[model samples]
Target: MSEQEMFLLPPERPTISHLRMFLSDLAMQYHSLATAALNGDYHTSHTPFFTANGNIVGSTRLRALIHKFNTEFSDYMRGKGEKLKLVHSRFADPLIRSPESIFSLKKKKKASQAKHAGWNGYAIP
Candidate 1:
């Protein structure tokens, strides 16, 4: 594939199978993120292939399948791009369920700080 080439879905119409094929082809073509990024040309050339007119849409089943494949493809690319050293963390499962976890303290601190300010709402800081 040419470095600048991108797989664009038909502008007027696309099918679920088209999306699946696009993502799969994308994953195969760019298994390394550096390669994906390179093939993507830093968002100038390629964007991730799933989207309805570049937004997300479809039946529930199709959407779920697309997301699942996207995640798997991304994970696979990350694995291949060891030079980039991406880390995937499953931080919520164990910590959120455990009372001994210090995460609640951090949350409380943020909440209290939000209260101290004249704001009645919490926002990420």
Candidate 2:
């Protein structure tokens, strides 16, 4: 091997635990923003939410994780290195079908199926 090759060190190792922690933080931040949006407090586009080093802190693990996730997900979606792309829809029909609709259907089914608390209430068996 050439001296340049020998001098080049491998990148630091990151494991599934790191990814999981990153995912957990991302989920928390997303949930926060979603709650805010649901409350009619969605941040405006002119606001700093879409910009780098905006109102949010920088140089943090969560930011790095988000950046990494965006890059990887974009690449994955575009089939950058891989030969395939995920066929899942990012957005679903809001009026005709939604997560709430699924939950409503489930509740209706449960109501029709059972009279006891196990099937009618929050408790699941």
Candidate 3:
């Protein structure tokens, strides 16, 4: 009935059911991504959500989703304030670090070492 619909071959036409299914799948994938990211499993959680129908989703849409979710997470963390510490600080964390601490690379003496140094204090010349 619409101009776009009229231009399509009958077999090529996408039905409402097809769009609904695609959105449903997207919602499920987004939910999975959110939950896994919250659980700190970001590396593994993102792989399946980044693809659909055996193909990677377009970069523009993927970037929007990543940005949107990251912003939401940042906001939530800001709102929660110290509440997140109750969940995460229970165990000693490898990220517990400070300048002058061995695990802390904040003082980049090693990076500044002539063995690895280059232009403008960056590795790149």
Candidate 4:
């Protein structure tokens, strides 16, 4: 079956332990993806969250998760005086700019200058 269909398929009767395990795995995956996005690993044309055509992948699952969390999880947490907020939105760019390319460019320029400077083991004095 296609990946989309797989995602859409509801899980069979799951025990509490199975549900907990599934949620834990899902949380970890979300954390990893969020971290990558924050570190500028994803670009506009390429992101696991969106298809090449700009449609959100597994959107139904995403919506259901968000709805359940907002309603059930948030309420449960709030009773304990804990605050949890989940914002659903799309970002046009990464959270931070990647500096590795800039650093590499500067290194290359310095190396080029050094190669062209001075004489063999001596300065032009």
Candidate 5:
């Protein structure tokens, strides 16, 4: 082999205990990332959350885990589905559907109390 070429063995299969510990650590790391992401959403557009090597986080793996968590959490809440009810709507985009709509006079013409407004609420015809 050339001096620039090197061979490295793959990681060994972890034992059950080691696997548990590794998963626990990974879960904690993921939790911190999610919390930081949520907290930073309300603040500046930047965040200090990065790996020790200064690499950007939130890979496909992280996104998959987030989806999994959301799914599992929703499943867990299925037993409490009876307690929730339809809540009133809230203003989202001012230029789309609000009393103080902005942007332009055309926006005022385009704005409506109709269903096409920007909202996360349940849709009804």
Candidate 6:
């Protein structure tokens, strides 16, 4: 097998949680390296990957990749939050349960009773 194929192949499929954890670890390392560079603490031997001023060579591509990841991840999280809010709203009781006027008193009473009759007002049935 080719070197790329060998690297790509794994004995088992990794779980989503594991992949997220791995990415989180990588983000932490990246943050640490960036902070060290900003604080002038980063020191390295002469390498093609870095310049004399401790800046990464070809950093534009890296910045683009980081920006893309941030945008995608933020969008994903926002979508997830919206979905969760939708689901919660589907089963949630109204905050204004009390009757505003005498005309709505009976309806409000019925709704309150029905809410309490279910499992914490969130039962599907």
Per-residue C-alpha lDDT of model 4 across residues 22-95, encoded as one tens digit per residue: 88988988787766555555544336463434555444234445676789877886686534333344762343
Once superposed on the true structure, which residue ranges of model 4 sit more than 4 Å away at CA? 1-7, 43-46, 50-125
Q: lDDT per model, in order?
A: 0.55, 0.60, 0.60, 0.62, 0.55, 0.59
In model 2, where is the ten-residue run with the lowest total lDDT? 42-51
- Model 3, poorest ten-residue lDDT window? 81-90
Model 2: per-residue Cα lDDT over 1-125, one tens digit each: 99898689654439988777878977988777655444544354323443357666433334455677999999887875655333336584444355566678889888866755556456675
Better of 5 and 6 by lDDT: 6
Candidates, ranked, lDDT: 4, 3, 2, 6, 1, 5
Runs in model 5 deviating more than 4 A are: 1-13, 41-125
Q: Write the per-residue lDDT of candidate 5 for residues 1-125, one digit (tens) a residue.
A: 65444445434546998778878988987776676555544122234443323444434234445777999989988866655343345754434453233346556567664546666677663
lDDT of 3 by residue, 8-125 (tens): 7444428899878878988998787767655545346375554554455534244556778999999998887563232235575555543235435544566557546555655565
lDDT of 1 at 18: 79
TM-score of each: 0.18, 0.26, 0.28, 0.31, 0.27, 0.30
lDDT of 1 by residue, 1-125 (tens): 65445445334327888788878977876565446443433333334442345545323234466677999999998777554332336854444444444568778899888777874458643
Assess candidate 4 and give its TM-score to the true structure: 0.31
Q: What are the runs in model 3 whose C-alpha is more than 4 Å off?
A: 1-13, 45-125
Backbone clash count for every predicted candidate, in the order shown: 0, 0, 0, 0, 0, 0
RMSD of each: 19.9, 18.4, 17.7, 22.0, 19.1, 14.6
Q: How much is 104 displaced in model 3, in angstroms?
A: 49
User: What local lDDT does model 4 show for residue 12?
Assistant: 66
Local lDDT at 93 for model 2: 45
Span of ten consecutive residues with least summed lDDT in model 5: 42-51
lDDT of 6: 0.59
